[model samples]
Target chain A: MLNAQVEPYQRLRENLSQRDRSLREKVMTLEEAASFVQDGMKVGIGGSTMSRTPMAMIWELVRQRRKNLSCSRAITSTDGDILFGSGVSDHIITSWFAQGILWGLSKVMRRHVEQGLARYEEWSHMAVGMRFRAGGMGVPFLPIRSMLGSDVMDQRPEAKQIDCPFTGEKLLLVPALNPDVALIHVQRCDAYGNAQIDGLQFMDIDLALAANRVILTTERIVSNDQIRRAPDQTKIPFFCVDAVVEVPYGSAPHECFGIYEPMLNHMEAYVAKVNSDPVEGMREYLERYFYEPKSWNEYLALIGMEEVLDASQKGRSIYND
Target chain B: MTDTTRYTAAEILAILSARQLKDGQVVFAGVGTPLLAATLAQRLRCPGLTILFEGGVVGAFVEPGKLPPSTNDQRCTKRANMVLGSADVLLLLQRGYVDIGFMGGAQIDQFGNLNSSFIGDPAAPKTRLPGTGGGNDISSLTNMIVAMKHEKRRFVEKVDFITSPGFIRGGTSRAESGLPAGGMFRVITELAIFGFDEKTRRMKVLALNPGVSRENVQDNTGFDLVFDEQIAITEPPTEHELETLRSIDPERMFI
Candidate 1:
């Protein structure tokens, strides 16, 4: 029999800090925040494909050689490739994983998945969000119409077919996906972890509430007064976040909304190299980008400031006053 | 050099897909050709058409000479629009708010089933595709316009996997399956335009492009295709359509 007093959700709620917690500064180093991710944990990544990806933290995990992690995102991009390539994550659950539309598929992913080096658990885009919603709400599962008759339903045993009790219509039920930790990047947030996301919040809100712990990486740690001035904008509260690290351009290479766009030249270079030789090329990329670089700043230096400046101008220009 | 008079294979596909859209229909566009085709529709023909990205961008005007590399890119959200959560936009499909699901897949069958997951066997596949993003949800809840090149290897008797379901086993099956909104409406290709027969759910050629013979259509397709009683000739892309499409992509990144 299940214990009524010790429900998993009740326990999780208790872990979420009380009133004074929001007042306390949650700032920490990137290394310290990333250390919360242990081997073989189910981690949630914020942002959609090629936009607002928490790449710096992922690189940190790779540098730390964190292995066997099961990661999930609403949609994935080169970050997923880095996770698989670095062996930081063995299992990746998501809706999609292409680098981009024009570039087509990721050769790094193709080589690893086809060769049986990693595990890929696929779900429809809506289904992934609804599953996270179910987790956040502390429900066992949520019913939706996605993958009703498609082979995608057959691939996922977790999703069940059920006749709607009210309307007698067929529906598919997807189970809750509660990750152990969530890595998110925002445009700006206070040291107290009052974070605000600028662009389309692709499922980060659901992921934040569902995950047991949240590691927030921000472009800059603004003052609490600044966050309070725009109280309505704070999407991630300090009560849910355990660590906050200010890593400017945290989502570099990948586009960071209101900050910079995708560094196409760098991405093209990466794609070309990886396509030429998936295995050896991937290893070299890791060594050059992840391993050899002493710090995140050094990696930025390698990418060159000119590319960053150009991307910044273009990305910021997209937003008209 | 940029060629405006001559259209490439991708250009023609974009043009045909654009022509299929009406004036003010909200389209759920996927990445690559679908996005380009939908944007071309908004620009050249239907200015009132609303292009929706799976990443939750709605009603944004794509700027000239700056096509987004992906659906979620900043370029996809250039003009005035409301940006909601990704879940918020896809949930509209359940409410019958979206009109078209424009996308392309790795393989498609006579029944309109799509395979975007893998090429070979499930256990051991030759090529591993990016799993269905909003492919299934889009096709399941709204009318789909599948655009792809006509090739024997692509148009198969049966898909390797059904990443998105169309008509299941034919007549009335999609409706019977409890999907409230829509089904496969049209299939656009470089060589011809086809539609699913209401009774049989089989892919049938409605029109052939200029210089494309019936034999060319049959020989290029993997399976036997049904020909409509009145097969029409598809008009070639006009100079304006070709020029505008080229201007959209001066570098020919996608054209």
Candidate 2:
């Protein structure tokens, strides 16, 4: 029989032990996490135009020649189209692409639809409103009047059309998006996986709630007690988290606060190279970054911090001291 | 006061420049002519006006003379208070926070319907340009909307696609649609300044540009260009307005 007097302390110790074990088992390298994403899986990414994204893992997936491993259904607020253009994704459900700079990226997406390589579903910003509302309400679907007479309805036949018995106005039904997995990057997390997103709260909050499982890559891992000390900032509670990988400079080439400056030169070079020779450029990138890495540290070493710093100084807008 | 008869871009600048602007006034600026007008309004007219770009930069400031290609131009980020996602901007508009919206269309009918979606045919088009880029929302919501375009075939008898609802058939349906009252108040063009009729809401030419005759304006337009009995030439730019507009944008005179 357990002693009642020591039960609370014993429970605390057990919780700590479980957290420690999970942290020990967390995948440190991008390649390891990339491997977890299988072929023909619908994936949800967390980002918007020129903001937070899991670029490292995406780059690794391309490098490893992870063929036949395509996202069956891809969803993002923005920037995911850039990934799709890089030959990473097949199908997509999104609003707009690059906000107009890369005009006809949507045209390319249409070509993919024409060739039957993938299916494309164009959503308005209203769809985002409906999805978030459904996720927050824990409902299966939400009714909205946005796509009533628009071409969006014809594109998404799966969306149920219902007549408003009261007004007789047609409303397009958007399905609740419960993603198979949500991969997010945050500023800080605890050993037990309670995460805090310091800067702009894009769609991370809703994404965390809507996804079936959450995998987080964070800048630092602290004690659970530290997170509890300041509960207001802890956006994602540990209960919802499936795994927490503490990767310093994890949002590298993308700004993660108190970590590293963004790799803007790298991003620009990537955009230019991809625009010039997409297939060959990606192949060269894979050979240079992934296959050549003897280990994770070797991979990290190849991206020199000094080079990033220099690039930042030379007119690249990266957050650094 | 007597010099209020010679029209120029600077005089047009003065009309927007005299208005008092509060902080956080969401100004949605369209491309080309409206871009100049809005930029001048911000720089010379109202410094506190928060310019919201269709490409998603909120409260962006242009560096003295540079006009960006689009709202998402890199310079826009460099000179912005905050860069919001396009989706977020649309959300803000839906909530009715946008104060003023500016738009231009290829064809605007007597009913205030704009056509920018297609050119020749819906099924098969001769020249299919970029369809409506958020003009639908911009024309619908903001407290007041300003329409600017060079009056021509682009400004036609009837638009091919109703990309935006201007006066939407008439005032009754427009008000019923929950659009703000005083719908589509003004239409500014290279040749004239027109206002919607009180009862019909059809565009009535109020003033003409200097050196532009009624016949020239009518000849260029596909529809019957309405005119007022007392239609006068617009006032020319003052030294202050001209200097300010020129200083802000030296390359083009959007008047």
Best by lDDT: 1
Q: How many angstroms is residue A113 displaced in model 2 relative to the true structure, after the best TM-score fit?
A: 5.6
lDDT of residue B187 for candidate 2: 70
DockQ of every candidate structure: 0.77, 0.14
In DockQ terms, which candidate is top? 1
Residues A25-90 of candidate 1 have per-residue lDDT tens digits of: 888988999878999988999999988899999989999999999999999898988999889998
Model 1 TM: 0.96
Q: List the residue pairs that clash in candidate 1.
A: none
Residue A235 of model 1: what lDDT?
A: 90
Q: Mind giving the per-residue lDDT tens digits that candidate 1 earns over B123-176?
A: 798888998999999999999999997889999998888898888767777777
Q: Per-residue lDDT tens digits of candidate 2, residues B175-239?
A: 55444433566676656667788777777788776566888778767788678899988755556
